[model samples]
Target: MASSAASVLNRLLQNASRPKKPSQPPPSPSLILHHINSNNFAAAFSALFSIPTPLSIPLYSRLLRISASTRSLVDARHLESHIISTHHPRHPPTFLLNRTIETYAACGSLRDARELFDEMPRRNGGTWNAIISAYASAGHSHDAILLFSRMNKSGSSRPNDVSFACALGSCADLLALLLARQIHCLVLKYGFAKNVILSTSVVDVYGKCGIMSDARKVFDEMRERNAVSWNVIVRRYLEMNEGEEAVILFFTMIVDGVRPLNFTVSNALVACSDVSALKEGCQIHGIAVKLGFDGDHVVENSLMEMYAKNGLLEDARKLFDDSTSRDVVSWTSIISGYALCGRFAEAEKLFDSMPERNVVSWNAMLAGYVRCLCWGKALDFIFLMAKESEEMDNVSLKLILNVCAGVSDLELGKQVHGFVFRHGFCSNIFIGNALVDMYGKCGNLRSAELWFLSMASNRDKISWNALISGYTRHGRSEEALNAFGEMQWETTPNEFTCSTALAACANIFVLRHGKQIHAHMIRNDFNMDVIIQGALVDMYCKCRSIEYAINVFEQATSKDIILWNSMIMGCAYNGRGEFGLELFEMMLKDGTKADNVTFIAILLACITEGYVDLGHRYFNLMSDEFGIIPRVEHYECMIELLGKHGFMVELEDFIERMPFEPTTPMWMRIFDCCREHSYARLGERAERWINESNPLNPVEFNVCSGPAMEPS
Candidate 1:
């Protein structure tokens, strides 16, 4: 039977040997339905192609769904061809064409989707949303935003809530506050103000764009709220590092009787992690357990992160080990947790044992190594990651740039710079800033300036800080001050830049400029965090302005140990040893703990006061009382104190009882001290040791009262 049918069909296909006056039969819709019912969309499409008949709108919509599900560009194109045959070439049904555009986008051929959309003679809100969502989801935020603008101006389509939501999302992604506000106005003008989803999107955009007050206003105005709205507002606070606000909102959500979902619990945990709120995290964990989200993978991972970030590594490890549904995120979180606490060996072990890894996982490990300053291993891991074709994003590049700066690997930094340009990440200002920082720290000031200038209008406070810090770090204090001057003209000085400026002033002893910066900070209401306060004290002290330094220290509302140390050391160095001692007593009374640097200052004070007995007691107190087990610097200060007081036997005994062999600098310091005291015998012995330690650069002191110079 098959052979007979084939032979007859073959005779009919041989160019019709006999002409017949027969009519072409109508196409069978049942055949198309049969193929469709059997779930063979490709075959159904083929049958439709053969018949070339119009399909019902419902059937065409069904076909579009199938094409989109398959995500096959071929299926999309075939369906489009059938649509064109069924309708006018320039005008398919608007709804059908909208779905077609979406199908093309889902197939990842946005160009084809766009061409179809452009060729459409008419469009509706769905048409605009289809393309806008496609671009937004694919991370082309700029293009998506542009399309939304065109849609608004064309007036061909009255965009609905979805269109505004997608546009607002793109605005959030781009941080385009102005466009976000415009879209927000459109949402109101178009009467979508009551839409909860649209409202949440507005809040998200405002929060992400750093207009928190506006975000809060929109959020408060929402007459009705959903879990999504709460989550969006809370997560916005987390993004801004306002962990307290996020946690407060989470509690408010619970009090409002809105039970948190798994992601909600996860976000709350992240907030706790941000603030190191272990008790609150534990409370959330209890809530999760009661809500049955404790077993959820997302909540579990966040729990581990919370514990780890709060330095409860053992608790985190237990959760990691007990997790039953650990995904890649779970693994990455646990790995990052270990790495956060300087346990790289354990982190790498877990990372190696992971079942699957993504770029986040790789970057987390790299960040761990970078944090621990294991520069060589970080470079190796990133290189190996690249060799394995793992996609390196901007974070990885920044880490590599940091490593290059740390190791002064200028050649490698340049290569990474080239990679940045090639990979089209040059527009990322953070990466550009990293490049400048890398070049600056690597001693390539010229490259640093060039990169900074190339940034043009993109230069932010960090760029200026990096340039000025480089000059300050490498002892070009004058240039650093000059750069700071230039920065003041280009942009308002931030706290970091002001701090660097103060340091430059101190280095050059330009008390006038330091006073000006201090006044400017006061006038501008700059963020006078503890760090800036410390810098102010250090600058004033280093410039020999003990009175002014005291004024800054006394005026500071908040003071850390660093500030205390700076004040003490400044007083001691400026010949106010007794007052420096009083400050130390005050530091202790104020509940501030002293470190090794503090004791060094104390020893210096004792030396200035000629209290040899007190210096010995304090040196002993470093180990016996404070448990600071003195470092070589502390020991040197003690020996200098003893030698300056002509306590020869005690200084020699202190050097002999040292835990490690004396270094050239230690011996040189000893020789200078011995010469100061006219202790000739010990001076010659110290000279002998300096010569033995650094033979190439022989010591040339003549036992006279001349200033010491660098060995040559």
Candidate 2:
């Protein structure tokens, strides 16, 4: 009895010391829903996994919806796995599974979305729409269209309004007009045309495809128009260069009581800028201010650009200064404004003062300098851009390469080429063209050709033009003509291509090639442009076909200053100086003002005719009357005219009173005239000037001195 009692006590003690199982809490669906509703997804996710009971289909569906709506793809995926693992060969509820698929699609995990979509034993319209929209949104338009067709053929689920919208969007993206038209017909057949969103999509697609009429027709047919509808058509008109139409539409929108959105105002302003309708632009600006959109960055930037384009720099500056918040675009606008107005120093100063600088700002500054012909300053900015660790994009590199070409800085261009290679921008077609052009301009034809050949598959007309122009510029006319011939088989020659090729023909005096190119131009209808006409005139003159040049000139219905100058120079080159002078008078009478080139041409004509008085009158008239500064070439022409007339005393006095010292070549011209007229004393003075100009070239100086040393 005693041992039994001891064993019972020991058993009781052991039982007392042992741990008891704690009561498990029930799953709180309300708590999970609350956390999810409050966007405390982490807490909800944690609460979900802690549930002791098996998750109901409703609960799982709710969680998946929350995940899908919040884009909690990770949690949605996790819950999906749990449902699959727990069900184990028994399918989860269709709603829960579909929500999971939608979540994946929304997260850009189309791969997972597709796998889940295919794995479902049963599918619904929502599931198909989810996957198709995902594909379309990811820029896989072809795949989206293919899947839509497959969905149609399946006949399992009829596509709804959302599906049609997604499919139409895909068609629009692909710019597949035929497919889009079929889809439009489908929309009509399915009676989805009444859906405003679908109708808007149709209009947008047509507009983007450059079918403005079709876009307008679709837009007009909309039973009820929204701001989006108006914006689309207005923007399309601006893009199609129909600025007046865009402005009219904006006024119509206001009359119809549709409030213009920011985009509408911005686009309307862009149209105004395009047409240089300053009054219309200012009206829009006032409307934007009244609408309280002037404070908006995008609208303000557009307004600034419009003002600048209209030459209202002060107004643009005022707008820029008044803005409370400024972005890179704002800075770029103001900089470009100053640049367009030729205030490069101010532009640079503004660029330096910017709180932040981006590639666009840098590019704007570079372009501004280039426009002002500040090549050295542009190059300096490029170097500074490099030092700042800013990755030079294709535009930056292209701009710098152009500056290098402008200044003929080959070493800097080579360095930029190295930068291009290092950054792997060589494969870009524009950069490739720029590189080829730069090399050609720098007198590195071999490298230019190599770069041109390297861009074999990427070569466009621009590439061909750059190469051909480079060759022509460097006097490699044969290569230029050969390149032009090759270009004919590769691509149709543009106006620039034909113009540059004609220039090559002119340089070599190849009338046959010129005629052939001219025939090509006529065949292709490329000769109507004034630029090409000017080229043809110059070409014929160089080929000694003065009559052909004159015929071409007479046929030009409207002649710009360049065309006028080309004709005048052609007459001068062909020794018809008097005719050239007569043409100049005709040019003046035609209301075409004479620029510096015109003056040069007329002066050359005077020199050709040995009209000393006429040359003198025109030279003074150029600066005094027309306000045209006389460049070195003009001075050179004056010297040549005086020397040719054997006016030694006058020539010497003119040289001594000139604003600039006479160059070696000018003195050489004088020396040649002295020899021709037997003016030994003046010839000795001209010899001394030439020798003093080239102190390093003693041998040439001795040779030049021999003539003056001769006793005449």
Candidate 3:
């Protein structure tokens, strides 16, 4: 029965083909629209638009109108099917198929666009233009340029203004200036210089490629302009960090009645923050709010970032709180603001309260902890992330590794090393650099060297800095200097490299080598770096050149807390005890809050001068007013001061009340004092301490009884 039915249909088809007059291709539009409406769009679009050579624009427009209405109903699979049905057969005209592909490209369905591109039967200028624009829009400029070359070779359809414009856009995306100029010449040959869209695209391309003069020439010649034309110049100024120029362009755009988009306001606000024009930022803020763009995420994020950068944390926090829906960036901005303000505990609390956590969130928290010297907790989070198999990105690993280096936890550091090794991240440059730092901080310079050698690539400046710093930290100053010389022979030393080597020179008292590094720093214009300057100051002081140290300290253009500490401590350590005292008092008067290290330096200065009363007063003030409890070093200072004043009885009482066990050095000082003063009663007490410190060295009574030093 089925064979009979097929025979009947074949007979009817044969008779219809033999003597049928042309009937306008059976009104393919109506049939195609029906098929498109009934969800048989693939078959309908293919049949209606399958006239091979020059595709009709009117028919293509009709099909596009229908497709545009059902855009939300289109899925990825439907787009893929359309590309397949149109390109695989020689039926669809190149222009119509290309037009349909443009829709998919605009919708960001590059995968579908590529599928159609690969299947095209007869490619032409329109087809190549469609593919090139898709690739450039999707940020695959290399692919776009490659496709344009293939299209030029085809020579089927001549390149037009759209073709050259699209190709130039690709080159701009790639930042290929040479290629863009070549395409601009092609645009001129096509006489499309008068095309407004093409001209503006050229301006945009040149502006993005940093050829601002050429972009401006093109812009000035344009008799017609649009929003995009203004944005090109505005963004150009913003890129140059010329906030004033960008503001002028924005005003011109607005006065010209070109309605500013959300992106335009966002870019201008970013420029304001770049130049730290806080007043300009606040004015732009009001404009964005009035324009109803304040609630937009991109605008809000930029505003928050602007306020944060300008040190307006309160305003940033208020903007963040005003947002009804806060994303990870919102939380990171506020938390990072706290970190910038030195409110580490508050930053930690905000980090904990965040409902969502991303790598940025973790990085902000880790940086905060590192700043607070809570490196142990920072490392804990790093390990926790590893244990949970969360994405351990290169940045997070580097941050944690730096914290590991700071605290010098060898065991925990080794565990992280094991994780890096297992995860195949050991070869990553950043991870490798951080690993060098971790091993160095753990006091395993050899291990650090091993890791350094294992890196598969040449080391960057950071890698060199880590290794040099490791050697310096381990008291291998000679080796560190050797590495520094080698580094200079191979690569240019950055400020950090010079600073790390200077720190080593300070540690080893290599005054000559340190001076050479200082010379190099000055030559490179890095003498102004506060860290490098501070390090040089410290180096000179450690080498006992207080005059040179003072010169470096005084020459600093700006001073941070570290600079103040370095100068004060250097003065205290280099026999300039009086100067150190004067600097400390000046620092206090200047409103530089004295940290624990500051107090320690000043107290040591007083101890050196035998101003026992003043030392005690500072200690009491640090404890009571500043909330700095005495640590072991502070207690040692008190003990030494008391012993120096011949107060053996009081020194004993002070040592007894210490929160930690007194080291042998602390006890030996008391014993020496007792012996010097001929205090027989205190001598007996000191002897007991020495015996207790060394159980094997038993005290023996002699005809002139005295304490033995040690066992034979």
Candidate 4:
């Protein structure tokens, strides 16, 4: 046994002394990564620590990457400390430090990431990128920009593609056009333009800065383009209200053979929606199907919205029903579409059917009710929304306030105002504008002024316009004019602002102010749209400038029926019945179809001029030739014509044949005419009808009885 032990010890020493063939070096760091990737984290970590210091660097990097990806801050910190302890006094390799910084940033420990970045004895492009990206992702855009400037000044590290992309993103967030341009110059100087991501980032910066011309220029200059590059420009155009141009660019993108991403498809559909370009929308929808993106929820929702906004509710409904994955936006889009198309009942039904509802979904339904003039339903929805936990947003308040103003419901407007205060939405500029308009419309000028004063610092053109329009609506024409002058001193008035000012001038018959506004329109080269033309024509006529009204009418580039009606009514009011008839004939000659208003104006002219035959002819022709059903005013014109001409029998026959009961005002008109002609018998008949219409009010009967007067 002694001899065997001696021989074994001799053999062990002999084996140790033998120059052993170098055993295959311990499993590489890649092997350790293989274990980590397979989720054998225990074994991977054990192997990581067991490896030599030089090998451990790569192993630690792989582990840090996994930690960052999984957002395991604990493991990340542990690994970071291990790297620090293992490589202390001498700085860790730049790549390991970068990965560690990235891990910390990804874990939302930006403080740690930034501290480690600061402590790093050396940094490359990757180190700078990680920290800049960290700051940008955290919404510290200014800090990110400052760091990027430091990187540019630091001669040790040059701005690479990643660095440029991060810096450009910061500029985008900051909307720093000058800084972005400088960075763009640096990108070009550094030959980073060929990097697709860097180029895309530059384009995005320009877009966010509202420099679409530059954005397009950069995009056009790109040697290579991707889906993101196309999307950025298309979305920018949409934001700029160049929807038609956006659609054109979308088609151009398609022809360029770049495949549309999901975002691209959604943005293009928005462009189509804005322009109401149904044909182009349909073509894009077809492309989406071919690209298999039609099934994508965002694209489907956008398509639904486009169809809805274009009045293609049928197609919108079809798309809604066909969508397999319907989210809140999908339901909201369809509901809003129905509401916008004036199909309130369908919108309500669909809204009730939604399984899950958000604030946006509720707002859409409420807005629909308001738009369809279902005032009671809209108010009820507001109350219903109050009962729920879902908080009302600014859009909800704006829409409901509009409904209150439209229905002249002061009580409800006050309630909405209270809600705005309670919800702290009073500070929202849009809500402030809405409140001003609502209170003005409700005849609560005090409240309107209060809200307007409160929002003085935040007042935009819309805010000023709303106030001016409100004053005009309530017959505070002088106040509206003063407000207009104040607005001009503060901000440049838009077309709406000028148009409302013109309306104020018309209401007060201020010829001087009207002339000034007209001159301003001319100097500013404002487009003579139908609204402005109508306003000018009405203003001239109201100011006793019928020739000027006629001049304005003739200068209109494209006259809709409203403009034509305005001119006709102007002539009628000025007692130019002959000229009114001439204008009507001109309207017909120009293929401008007459509506109920047209016939009403023409009938008024006939009545004023005592053209009884012409009155009868136009009244009959209204329904027979023009398909315009005679409204109350048309009937009033007819009755006035017959009563003034002493055609009592025909007037009585017309009254009996009327479709609806004569309102109190209509009966008052008949009684006045009877008194004018001293027809006691006919007067008594009209008096009895008025009394019957208001049995409880003897005042109306008494007033009519004592109202006999001399004929004109």
Candidate 2 structure quality by residue, lDDT tens digits, 209-276: 87989999998888888898899889988988899999999989988989889999999998988899
Off by over 4 Å in 3: 1-43, 46-57, 60-128, 134-141, 147-261, 267-281, 304-392, 395-432, 444-447, 450-459, 488-492, 527-529, 606-629, 638-662, 676-681, 697-712
lDDT of 2: 0.86
Q: Candidate 1, residues 271-301: lDDT per residue as tens digits?
A: 9999989999999999899989878888899
Tens-digit per-residue lDDT, 31-58, candidate 4: 7778877998767766655555555655
The per-residue C-alpha lDDT of model 2 at residue 276 equals 91
Top lDDT model: 1
Q: Give per-residue lDDT, candidate 3, residue 239.
A: 86
The best candidate by TM-score is: 1
**Root mean square deviation (Cα) for candidate 3:** 7.9
Backbone collision count in every prediction?
0, 0, 1, 0
Residues 1-712 of candidate 3 have per-residue lDDT tens digits of: 9999999999999998897686664444556567766877567655653433322466455556556455522643443355445554556566766866776776667877788778777777778888888887778888888887777777776777766777787887788888888878878886888888888888888888878889889988988878777877788878866778788777777778887778888888778777888888898898888889988998898898789878898899899888998999889978876875567777778877988888777777677677677766777866676665476677777777778778877887787778788888876898888899889888899998888877735577777888898898889988898989987766788888888898889888999999998888778776467888888888999999999999988887777778888888888787788888898877778787888888878777887778887887888899899888888788778877877776666666676777787777777776766666555565667678788878897553222334533223
Local distance difference test, candidate 1: 0.87
Question: How many steric clashes does model 1 contain?
Answer: 0
Candidate 3: count of backbone clashes, pairs at least 3 residues apart or interchain: 1
Deviation in angstroms for 291 in model 4?
A: 3.5
lDDT of 2 at 418: 95
Badly placed stretches (over 4 Å) of model 4 are 1-38, 42-55, 150-158, 178-182, 185-196, 388-391, 424-427, 588-593, 616-712
TM-score of each: 0.83, 0.81, 0.70, 0.83
